[model samples]
Target: MADTNKQSSEKKEYHKKATGNALTTVKNHSKENDLKLYGSCFCPFVQRVWISLEVKQIPYQYIEVDPYKKPDLLLQINPRGLVPALRHGDWGCYESTVLMEYLEDLSEGQSLLPPQPKTRAHSRLWSDHINRHIIPSFYRFLQEQDQQKQVTLADELKTEIGKIVDVADPTGPFFLGAGISFVDIQMAPWVVRLNRVLKPYRGWPEPEPDSRWAKWVKAIEENEHVRATTSTDELYLDSYERYAENRPNTSQVANSVNSGRGLP
Candidate 1:
């Protein structure tokens, strides 16, 4: 019990500096809340759960954990020491998407999944597609140094992002419809990060003008939930820069300008 108390004190100290430049801090929610999230501000995966909590109006204690310096408590909850682990009372959950669904199940507010069964299934499918195909392909594209390979990667990423437009609802602002769904929460972090960080410096392509992707981007940017959950643009870019430098073979493109380059 004494050891546990000591660790809790250490985590609190770490959180003071680890909140980074996020627009939302622990202060946004009350300390008495039983729901606690262990994560860093810089992680987009973490942002997904954070956005869900805000959108659902679920009060959770946000505990910032440095991903690089895995704390004992974080490790105890998730053996991998990954960020975005959630603890409600004595129960714990890991993985951002899993925790998002768990939180949705536990809380009362806007349904993260769509009401229609088919649409909800589709939402789950899109989330899976993003995790399996889009993220990996885009990261690989950014890390590629060879000119021909970079071109190939750029095309791959363009095709993948275009898929989101193809799958998005034609009648409205979000991926599902008028309301933000689980799919939207899953995709928003990467979309926002890419637009702010990669689009300007690395020449990542924007969805075509007047297209569904364009509309979605505008709507997401205007979303109150997204606005509240997201960090400042300066901090977002700065964190991504640092991340690129840290990830192996990913630094070259992040460091270079895309002026007159083949990247699109």
Candidate 2:
């Protein structure tokens, strides 16, 4: 209880400080300015912006926020209480998929959105599909407590995930081709977790990342900007454990429904 209280207090303080800083900075911000990304380790969506910023070689201030208890400033900027919110100059934006488009406008490097209208439309189509279909599927597994249900979800998830990858990735390594595209940034975070989860969990088969995605991720990950987010594998593992610990004993919730009774 003490630890929880301390953590909550710190979040409150961070929120206060962040708000004061955001208004002053936004009031006098300019283009090509330093970027600020408020994100959670658990949010794959935020990871999208992280990858975009890295690929664009843009420097950003990364602020970690708690999804359970968000800071006031974060809520002030994004009332929806979403992760991966970004503040660029006076403009504050939320939603991981949308942030990809914003990154393209801020920095120039490889084009994330295709130049041609037809091709760009195709790109957006697949991008939206993953968020709509693929992400929810992950939640199904995340919520599962019974190993049997988890296995079922995992199997279905693997098949569906493969289709999403196979269909979206054209002939190139990157979803957009020769280089990493907005699709790459949008999908990479979830891909990393999906691939990692499959390796250790019995529910899913080992992942076979598309040739292009594998190569593109390697190259993009090597960039100086991307390196900041990449850390020892142990760090990622600790984060996963912390998330599980934070959740209200989901197993208990599942069992409550299992005992011929519903969650109360």
Candidate 3:
């Protein structure tokens, strides 16, 4: 308890500095106390913070940021100009994991991170694994066009999925046995998206061991916090087109120009 309080006090100091910059550049959220979240619907990092906020039962005013044309609020708040920047009254900060760790300390309503240090470390490890290993496969699966490459990407993704499943408590609906934790929230968005993305290819004729993965994927999708973060199907599909279609292309085009190379 003492350690938790100390962590909260320290984070508040960092947040105060960032919030000052955001206000100097743009009008902060009008509500005095509502938490402000700067993010895009398409960013999984931002999605992770959103899920963490949801699981903590923290109320935040969601503000969309166009990553292509980063607004002054985002630039000022993050300085590095990243999404998933968080503001709570006068305290604010950026980086999804930092925001999540801050919330885990601040909110006592539900403890997202485990109290035990070893367990907390494990959660952080898996969170890193999910972000590093699993998320890349997710983007690869999204970008891969050839059916064969998609299938291979799916297989590679299943291996990472197995790693997450290994850490998670299948007996209950979360990472830390019966209770939901920050670990679950951090990884839930991409885990759920895996099911949604691969669903279309499920019924198609395939010889690989995809059906088993499909079952596990469904379980991740059906988890309460995972489902809670969802959008309507029509909206989700439109969002898919917007994100998967344009963002990657824009990044590629920018890289091409900066490198003095032709577009593909």
Q: Write the per-residue lDDT of candidate 3 for residues 99-144, one digit (tens) a residue.
A: 8888887754678877798988889999888767776666665655
How far out, in Å, is residue 96 in model 2?
1.1
For every candidate, C-alpha RMSD to the true structure in Å:
9.6, 8.0, 14.0
Pairs in clash, predicted candidate 3: 112-182
Q: Show where candidate 1 strays beyond 4 Å.
A: 1-21, 242-264
Q: After the best TM-score superposition of candidate 2, give how far the Cα of residue 251 lies from its true spot, in angstroms.
A: 15
- TM-score against native, each model: 0.82, 0.70, 0.70
Better of 1 and 2 by TM-score: 1
lDDT per residue, candidate 1, 140-191, as tens digits? 6655557687788788877887887787889768997898889888888888
Candidate 2 has what TM-score?
0.70
How far does residue 90 in candidate 2 sit from its true spot (Å)? 2.9
Q: Model 3: how far is 84 from its true place, Å?
A: 0.8
Cα displacement (angstroms), candidate 2, residue 176, comes to 2.7
